[model samples]
Target: MKIKVIKRRGFEEPFSIEKLEKSITNALKCAGIGLEEAPKVISKVLEILESRMVKEEVHASEISDTIELVFIQKAIRNPLWLNAAKCYVLYRIYSDAGKVPAKFSKTDLSLSFNALKVLESRYLLRDPKTGRFTETPDDMFKRVAYAIAEAEKRYGASESKVREYARKFYEIMSELKFIPNSPTLMNAGTPLGQLSACFVVPVADDLNGIFEALKITALIQKTGGGVGADFSELRPKGDVIETTGGVSSGPVSFMKIFDMATEVIKEGGKRRGANMGIMHIWHPDIEEFIMSKCGPEEVLKNFNISVAAYDSFMEAVIKDKKWPLVNPRKCPEIKNALGKEVLDIAIKCSEKGVEVKWVNAKHLFDKIVMCAWKTGDPGLVFIDEINRHNPTPKLGKIRSTNPCVTGDTRILTANGWVPIAKLFEEAKRRGVIAGIVEKEREISKLGEEKGYETEILVPYGEKLIPTKAVVWKIGLKNVCRVIFKEGFELKATPEHRVKLKQGPWVKVSELKEGDKVETYGLWIKEATVERVERLGEHMVYDLSVPGYGCYISEGILSHNCGEVPALSWESCNLG
Candidate 1:
């Protein structure tokens, strides 16, 4: 009878001595043993295997165990053999660990075992008394579909239309063609219908504004949303607080408070709380912000930091000129603050009245590059470029993007908060809102108010603009988290641009701490940076507003609906 080996999954295959020899040879190489000794090692292992071959078949583990035993005996003569034994054992463990479980079969929908595990742990609804899963993956999909379809009723959709759309929704979801943000996945069909994933809260220069933003951040995070904000407006460290006759601790100090708050809420929130911090390059605390993540102590792990750079700043760096760091508190009062050239580009890029500090542009740029290279932090966002392409410039310049920079956010449509992705689907499929036909009147009403034809309108400020188009794509890319001093956070692709304090655009990957990005409210404001973190690669989405070139996500003014080229997907994570 042919010698056979029983695999871990209870399957038998013909035992191949050649394959075993190769595995042992690789292990010996890793132990720094010469290849010439591989044959000698193989012979010794074969002797043991032959002794154990009493039956026609044997477990795979038996062969591996015998090899390990032989290597252990050799270790007494040479310690390097011990490494070979460890290597072989680790290889076996890795092979077993990587084995995929059988396909999930509980539901009609096809899903991997890993996917099923995720659903069971986080997505599926649970029984109140027993805390066991109350529904299957199919049931969860149906629940979400039915609940979302029910919303059509509020918008004048008939019973038949609602059911029809629900069926359609179910088909796409069940087939794995379309999936909504995490909040929609977890909270939809449940009482916790707060489904927005990214928000931008304003962090003004005062104590009240900072704390208020923190409060809003906590609330949104509790509902599984991430926040982004610009901290550039806050006075730098040691700035006199005229009201209390005390020195300000600056944005970096306040960022710690936000970080602590996020850490606390992440423990209890429906999902982990995340933040984006944007500080302007001109801020006096720019150095501190850039190095925020580089501290010896692990601080601001919950936040991301970016430096808001400008065209002039980059130009100055290239020209080896001095760049002026202006005081936000005094910039507005300075004559011609937004002029083409400051006092003199060569000497100082500042007006006569504003308080400014000069730094070598190349030096600053080098610091940003070095820090990012070392710690993968303080990404850059070009404020001017983002505004130049702002789809909804009327909405105020986009200061910060959503957590994912993907347009998985809800656009404040005339009808209400509609998923931007859904609108994109409508645009892609039919170029109109025929599926959600009820929104036509609301869009028309909004257009009438804005003095434009209402095809589909997204709010800008007091006005609304017709949505020109919604675009989407598929690819793996780096998504970064940027945290502001007052606890605002946004996640976007590395190259996504955000507004700087002085109204310039810079990339998220190039942002350093103390850079101020735009934040939305009655008007646009700057939030200073706390830190920046690379959250790794993910499949992202984008939404564009075309002429408007921007949209308000949660409360932040985001470029072109999301970060760059449109939207980013920010979903709720279960663990």
Candidate 2:
């Protein structure tokens, strides 16, 4: 039963039955065929190959021909076995071209396994009829690059120039010098040409205008574009609808419709639909708008909610003044046709209800802050700040921010620390952290053993740059919020350490009340530790700071010495 098979390269090698069976199995799997008869089919193929191998050495093609001949004969016996054999036949072609490699070798274009999974699931071009992927990742990049470069040819480039630009574009992509948005990568060179990732749809007051915006929003979301809309123009709840002779459902009710519509539409059959809803702070239903995302369950989870806030509202909040919330329909000037067009006003069907609510601006601002703390929604958009540099004010005010916010490079901001790679870049500019980073340019690949993990550097107090300190600190760290079960709490980090007029600066973990030796202020008030109790994980001590504020673990208490009386803060934060 000893045999040697000849390869296409004219080389002789020992025949492996395992190899043949695995290849056939893969083919069957690719064709979505069952493996019930696979063992029998592989056995039969083996028998045929052995019978045909009369000589000590047999050609590989002969083995293939005998297997295929058996397939033709099996077709006469039963169509089931023949289908499996035919799958094997097609698998041969697929393996030679479309098969993903068992392993990715080290190369510039090589992708990670998960990256390949994502691309294979969606981005790779497939035959619509067969539902089989017809192109590889390299093919996708080339398709996207060439399709975009073709735009140059539309303006007046020759065929040669177009090809040259295509080559340059291909090089740019292959070298990882540039990458376009996901929609472009997916739809380029395909029938669907929509490539943008975000759209700002304007919602108008009337039913016609409102539905029109909803239609356009649906169209954009269907094509993988996220949409943002300003709902401030719509009248508040209980406002009259002149056309229908009924009360309006209001902007929030319409927002629910938009949310439901987005839920129904799956963007590009791959990405989920996304939306952003913005309402002005002066809207009469501002309180209702602020509390929209609160209290347990949610219907508009797909949306990123935001409030359009101006400097005047913030000023009112600061001065603790009663702010006027006005209905656009109430004023005669606002209701006039010319005023309506410029200011976006609509007539209320009746005037029986109160058109304005004068609320304490501080209370409204506190509510917004509290809701935002609960769920990371209702991000504030500073209206005055945005328009301070508006390029075209003549066109009208910019009401809604785009669905996606694009920024230049990676920069340090109030949001934690920058990326590790960004930190390394800054360190290089300052001539630091090279020894810490060594040669690993990619920060993600670094680990805890390498003196780093996933962490960002932020500022604490003074000019001190601190970190979650996992990686070489990016910047100073700041203590933002102290979460308490019902009161104040602090972690046992070195940052929570406070100084005493004795020994060295000790951690809040070590000291308790009645153990203090030094006077805090300009003179001693002759006070001993009043009380100590454990609230959850925090060991809090009563080192009363005149303001009824107690110290925890003797934790950093000086910084929070705001004489503004003890307040029940779910998240103790200072601006």
Q: Best candidate, lDDT-wise?
A: 1
Question: What RMSD value applies to candidate 2?
Answer: 25.9
Residues 307-385 of candidate 2 have per-residue lDDT tens digits of 8676667877898977666674453222111111212222231243535566798998998999999997777876566
In model 1, the Cα lDDT at residue 254 comes to 92
* Count of steric clashes across candidates, in order: 77, 11
Q: Can you write out model 1's per-residue Cα lDDT over 1-575, one digit (the tens) per residue?
A: 37888876677899897888887987787678888988887888777777778887888878877887888888999988877776664344333334222222233325543465456445666655544455656667788888899988866889999999989998898888998777777778887786677666656577866886687778778877887766776788998898989999999899999999998885123456888888777778888898889768788889877887777888888999887776656552211122233334313424345467888989999989988998878888776565566676543333222223544545556566555456555555642211111111222111111111112354444555444334443235568877878765766777666666555567778888887776654234667778989887655544544334566543455656334332111111122
- Misplaced by over 4 Å in model 2 are 1-109, 331-354, 391-575
lDDT of each: 0.63, 0.53
Please give the lDDT score at residue 244 for candidate 2. 80
TM-score of each: 0.51, 0.49
